[model samples]
Target: MEVKQNNLIKSLRIQPLIVVIRLENNFFNISDKRENLLLKIEKLSNCGIKNIEIGWDSNPEWVNLILQIKKKFKSINIGVASITSRQSLDSIRSLDINYSMSPYFNKEIHLKAIKYNQLVIPGISNIENFKEAINLGYKIVKIYPASKLGVKFINELQGFKKKDMFFIGAGGIKSKNLKSLLKLGYDALVIGKELRNQKPDKDLKIWLKNC
Candidate 1:
């Protein structure tokens, strides 16, 4: 688990950005939706995206979809996100994914992840949760609703940051503000809705080139 965690940290440092892809329910046209998703991922791969997180779903076919994605895109680092329940954890356990993430910290969920030897990065919104995450042996954490917290919130936590600790800023992150946020303190940023809502804009394309 330690080695896997370290590898993920190292990969994040090199790329420093994770594009999250959330699939909406389209029970009637699941096949078309899956194809659309593949095309979107191909576009991201062309844009030099190195990491991606697919939101977990309760649908039985979700696991097979992930397997297909992994087989199709071997180069990109794939992770599961929105893992907030025991069922969600169990769903991905057999997938052999390198890491997964929860939107908020849950002691029971996190402990179960450890027992399974899966690296689940906990999400923390405040000092209290952040401290608890550290105590649980987490070196990587996500700051959800990062824009709401602002740069000052992360900067203030610098004093408490442990060596090798990694911070991933998510929610309300735009291509324009990405660099500034990373400079402020976040080790990486997660861009989801913005990219999914529209094609990768010029600024994002330029940024990916340098990344």
Candidate 2:
């Protein structure tokens, strides 16, 4: 199933514009972590790029560093990520972040994020979790291993929603699948290894244009 091109989304959203940066892998200058994060955030800001999600579950220092990033770059939106880790709202309530996401969902974490009024995108790979999130008031859902399931399945899910719900795709995203994601019903995407090899700035711009 393909979207019939909604004029509202075309006008309001820069479709296919979500950039998910694995803070650990993308910013590889591990010698000085804080400085590394600042440099990446500042560079992206200088490039006139905005919207970034930083993943952290064990790196509590990331919470503080992200605050500094927000202070330094007011235009950028910061998000937190937890995958198969113990990241919880207790860890993030003090630090300022826009959202909390996981490659899979947990009832406790989801409930906590909701209480904090933090946007949460729980990952679900199958129909049961999908139905549960929809029933539990999730506006955004992450589709893990998006490359394996591919855009075809996402297109099928799009048919069930009345409004455009956020269907975020991760894993195995590349230049080849970018167009198909847009053609399908996915609302956003995250990348890691794809950006690690490219001229980050140029490739991002080219991707933005295509999305």
Candidate 3:
């Protein structure tokens, strides 16, 4: 687990941008939605995006979709997001995904992940949760709703950060603010709706190229 965790951190440090995709049940048919997602992932891959995280779903086919993605996009590192419950944790225990993330810290979930040997990065929004996460032996944590918390929150938390700890900024992150956040000390940033709402825009294209 240590080796795998180290490798994941290294990969994210190198690219520093994780494209998150959430498939919601909506008006569109599931087949069409899945196809569109695949196309978007292909586009991201072409643009040099190396890390991708798909939200967990209750649908039975969600497992199949993840497997299909792994087989199709062998070069991209895949992870699961929004892993907030034991059911969700069980869903990916055998999938052997690169990593998984929770929207907030849950001690029960974190302990279960350790017992299962799954690398589930906990999301933290307060200093208390941050400390708890560190005590739980997690070196990687997600600062959720990062835009809402702003750079100052991270800057203040720097005092509590241990050596080798990594922070992934997620929620409400836009291409325009990505670099600034990274510069402010986030190890990486997760871009979701803004990036998936359309094809990569000029700013994103340039950032990907530079990355």
Candidate 4:
């Protein structure tokens, strides 16, 4: 399948609250609860979650499922996991997704993914990764450990680069920090295990209120 981006720049302009894909392959027994969990996801969407993500770690079925889920949520925006193929975009190209991001953007596979109109976002830290990502033409940069770096880190980063280069902090984010992170001028950030854990909608409401 070939991916063609329609209004790609417009879609990328939004402030994203991405929930990364997490398969509970250990500890928690989710095998018998797929349907219920899917229901929960649907409910979350209904409750106004416009930004979401699917972390497909070499799984076509997962990508297909995410497509199906998207069919039901016409108003939502979705993104795929990071691409780190040593050979570049080979593996990511096959997924045919809207966006592809990762802790690293090795050549080849990444180039191929870009050809398909995938919005590539590479994880970066310090001057080296930032320069490399910009050189590679990735407008979005995921700041791996946002919690540790906080506002100070981003301020330091903007000093050297253009502020419009969509910056996202995803490693250790929580609902409590969303507003603060936003205030820091970060384009977006991911809520890690916080969203993965089962919690009541009321709790989510309270968290959002505080945020």
The clash number for model 4 is 8
Error of 1 at 67 (Å): 0.5
For TM-score, the strongest prediction is: 1
The count of residue-pair clashes in candidate 2 stands at: 0
Which TM-score value belongs to model 2? 0.79
Question: If both were scored by TM-score, which would come out higher, candidate 1 or candidate 3?
Answer: 1
Residue-by-residue lDDT tens digits, candidate 3, 157-209: 78899988999999999888877778899999999987646468888888887
**TM-score per candidate, chains pooled:** 0.96, 0.79, 0.95, 0.78
Candidate 2 residue pairs that clash: none
In model 4, which regions exceed 4 Å deviation? 1-15, 26-33, 86-96, 196-211
Indicate the residue-level lDDT of 6 in model 4: 33
Query: Candidate 4's C-alpha lDDT?
Result: 0.62
Alpha carbon lDDT of each predicted model: 0.87, 0.64, 0.88, 0.62
Worst 10 residues of 1 by lDDT: 24-33
Flag regions of model 3 displaced more than 4 Å.
Answer: 26-29, 196-198
Writing each residue's lDDT as its tens digit, candidate 4 over 1-211 gives: 1223333334534535676665555312455555654676676676656566755545445555666666766676766665666333454455445665776545565566566666667677676778777776766678877776667778877887764477778887777667667777776677757654633346455654554
Candidate 2 Cα deviation (angstroms), residue 100: 2.1
Candidate 1: RMSD over Cα atoms?
A: 1.3
